[model samples]
Target chain A: MRAFVLFMCLSVGCLAQRPQPCASPPLLTGSLSVSTQSEKLMAYANYYYDALRRRIRLTEFGSYNNKTFHLDVLLLYREGVMYKMNYKNQTCCKKPLSADFHPLEIPWNASLLGQVVIGSSSGPGQGVLVNTWEGELQMKEGPAKYMSTVTEFGCIPVSTLFHTIRSGWMVTSFFNNVIGLVDPQQLIPPHFCQGAQLEERLDEDPVTFFSLF
Target chain B: MRAFVLFMCLSVGCLAQRPQPCASPPLLTGSLSVSTQSEKLMAYANYYYDALRRRIRLTEFGSYNNKTFHLDVLLLYREGVMYKMNYKNQTCCKKPLSADFHPLEIPWNASLLGQVVIGSSSGPGQGVLVNTWEGELQMKEGPAKYMSTVTEFGCIPVSTLFHTIRSGWMVTSFFNNVIGLVDPQQLIPPHFCQGAQLEERLDEDPVTFFSLF
Candidate 1:
């Protein structure tokens, strides 16, 4: 009986120390603020994520480079295609997107940093408790380092910092986040995208591509 | 008949040329980006405006000065009181607020700068049509210059620029705005605020007070 109890205690301790991955809700809408050394991009976007369908959509209204732009980007992993719609110019471009769909979650191999409270910890419903995780992503060109802070309760993303060889350093913050989709139709490409011109170049990494504008 | 036609044409032309004030929706939820020479503050807030009741409430979660802060400011013009609550610390301060309520509208004295399209004007549903207005605010300290950009359709605010003797120059941009109130109770002070300590200092101008943190 003593040995069994000792084993049970050890097992419980191991489980407590084990790092667990946090998965964000399948659908969410929010505004993204992306900042880099080269440029600051302020955008209001609705994000639609369908893990089962392996599809993602981002409709963004952004201001940068002294210009305002509206873009609707769709990544259809099943179709292996990416549609980039310029709502302002009424133009659409299509390119091959071969990358797999990555769910919004902490990487399996990411190291767990200490948990922290964003606001006050003195009372319930007063602050947001978040966990910070960091890891190096597996990439074709090279390894890219990333750190993310996500809420403990809902696993909602708060902020992300990414550094890559090509993109340098970038920080993205999420705000005004809602858990469910405001409009599921946002996941579908608009009718204008049917006549998209095919582009020869392969689709670049999402983080890098977004920084272009 | 020709004289009558000419008179009608002139009346129509004059009506078209008259400048009209744009009033924003009473309630909104959006994210704000405030940039100044001294600091850059990024915040997500919900604004509740009651024109008849002469009340306004702003609940903001902001990051600046290398720290994150949560502030809930309630302006009760009818009561002639202002409540500033620090959600992070569970502290509240109340002070006399004698200023009259100002509805979110383009100033009557503002000069019409121009009507411009924010995105592509090539097609319908492609761009946002906005009007730019500039004016000097009537202030006890001095005349403060201000400029505002608002969408012509809904009169939604896009950006505002203000230059005052105390605050210098600051630019504020709004994004992800929803037209109606998400939660009406946000206009009411939290339970903790009932025990607020009365502050002696008069409330500073909102534009200048926000820049402090």
Candidate 2:
């Protein structure tokens, strides 16, 4: 059959010529579940990254019904500027490293329900791996159809950083590591964190830190 | 011919069954361009809304080369919380609005350069409508492709609130208004502007005011 239709059109053009996750930017650590309920366990985040020095460090501890919670940040981006240290309230803010602070943008998976299907690069490891196409999300006032699953780790793609109707209250990032490495004093601000001022200075404007969530 | 391939598969399934410009939530004002560079006006933004009381108010002015900038915010949102105040230096923050604060989730068209197509909803006026299918944004480092257009009104969609790669140097809300009406004392915090505290509370784990941009 004409060489099986030219070998299925050259293997669908070499899988549509791959490369589209976000180009290249994943060196991460994980643990997510910003808590929207359902399976329970209100909070618990944990990040650590390098993604070509966009640098990152997060630590969230949880406890809802009983009241325990904590947060620690360190965003440093360097050359392009992005500082935002605040380890346990030492405070320090600055901005410029745009793309909403890339770090692959944000959405870190958003859990695994099913059905988003963005270009579908599919099941792989390390870099250039996209995937979205499965999709559900219909909730106008709840319950109708809500299953989602956004993928990608290297290039970047959690449905372009989240919100497939909040993938049933998030929980992706069970664990990940692009080759690990993060502990240059966790970025900065710790020598007794004494007077660390400078609370805000957003210059490159990324939605004014749009709430850093 | 099989009824013309069943009328071209029911017109490509009615253009893929329309309705995906982000389900509900978009009654936004405008002003975006967080400055990535291109045009002249390095910054500018305007917004005001009620959206059934989800409340919102924004003001952004810019000058760049001569240095003259300003920012005022209000964002309310109730029932799911979202606060944010900040009129100049007044500061007041709180979080919980979830879906990234929902002004259509924040993207706000981004800018016009390449690939971003939503539907083709076309411009006419108010409510439910949506669009985006004009797309093109491939850039990894500098120009290679970047045309985008995202659309919506009654449920918001300036690319979900704005950030198209920062149009050359941004300055996007030339002017806009859902119907005006943002004078609820600009959401309070001006008895003399003297020490308006409360700058971060984000309870819903949206990343803890990552900067509230």
Candidate 3:
């Protein structure tokens, strides 16, 4: 019994098999109630990044359709390791890289009835999504469909050259609102450009150069 | 001087703009900031869009180095229409489209740069785009490029049917993120669907969908 308890406790701290975020500093927790103005104020994001082990008996999956969602949350470390408990179905999927940012494409999966992948967002670190089952939906094309959009959401800055590689999330665009561009390399410098004066030039004249950097 | 003032006033309200926003509702104005998770929370945003129009100037565009940032705030609007104002330039770029709902490809004239546009975007109405220079952008690749990047952004939601189209400013993704695959048609319903049932559905299901009514 002692051994079993010890094992369980250690597992809770950090799954030996994955890369997950532990109790780091500056934690944010809350619930999103309003559909307008201030929905992002709620912290503590929820995701079944693993897609296989994450399962729930209830159908509500991170949606705000009036249901009071209750679930333990897990944030994947930069290494892209999610446990089996994040998805409804339990089929393991792995990627050398994660679909973490947006304007990204999520490979097709059998479990996700209808899927959309918004990744590598240019917003703050609040780049998340709200989805629902297809059984409850309606598809319509309207006058807005004929239009185009643009924005400068959370464009990556040129500052942290020796830290992490995560890009902050910017303003997300709904069907109506569009955001601008933000580069993540601003926080964590790519492996190639280490000692160069990238931030200074960027600050002097804020322009993103894909080729040079 | 009096005669000149009257002529200027008449042109000010009717400066070759599309119909004013009748469907757009009052929106909340907020600062554009990014959250950083260190010993403290760091929020940094720039008014470059304003600088493009010669509105206000910042000390720098980005950091004066080669490091890349993950998240920083960009200018955006959600009251349906976005406002692009160059107070110094005395030009405004107005668009009467929903940031979360509308998706029109307002034909761009490169000269539309630094101009501000504002109008109602709750549902759909005529929208416009203007540039500062010759009023036309260079066509780098496809007709779409010369047109505007809004088309590619539109493809995200438009590709998926029956998806939710938000009504306010949203966080967007540039390269990769995870919330990219939401079928706007699936989550969104008709603009006409409202009232008790709508509220009930939104409240009970942890899921969100759009109405085509």
Off by over 4 Å in 3: A1-107, A110-213, B1-19, B23-213
Question: TM-scores of all models?
Answer: 0.47, 0.24, 0.18
Off by over 4 Å in 1: A1-6, A13-19, A40-42, A63-67, A86-91, A138-143, A165-168, A195-199, A202-213, B1-213
Per-residue lDDT for B3-78 in model 3, tens only? 9999998888686453221111111111222222221223233212121121211111222133433321112223
Model 2, B1-213: lDDT tens digits are: 999999999999996665333322334333343443332345556555555666666666666566786656555556454455554555655544544343333233333232221211121110112243223334434433322223333323232222244342221322232324535566443554434444355344432111222
Q: What is the interface RMSD of each candidate, in Å?
A: 15.7, 18.4, 13.1
Quantify all predictions' global Cα lDDT against the true fold.
0.67, 0.41, 0.23
> Poorest 10 consecutive residues of model 3 chain B by lDDT?
B204-213
Which one is best on TM-score?
A: 1
Which RMSD values do the candidates have, in order?
A: 12.7, 25.0, 26.0
Error of 3 at A78 (Å): 5.5
Give one digit per residue, the lDDT tens place, for model 2 in A66-145. Answer: 67766565666564444555545556555444343454442333333322222111111101222333223334444323
1 or 3, which is superior by TM-score? 1
Clashing pairs in 1: none
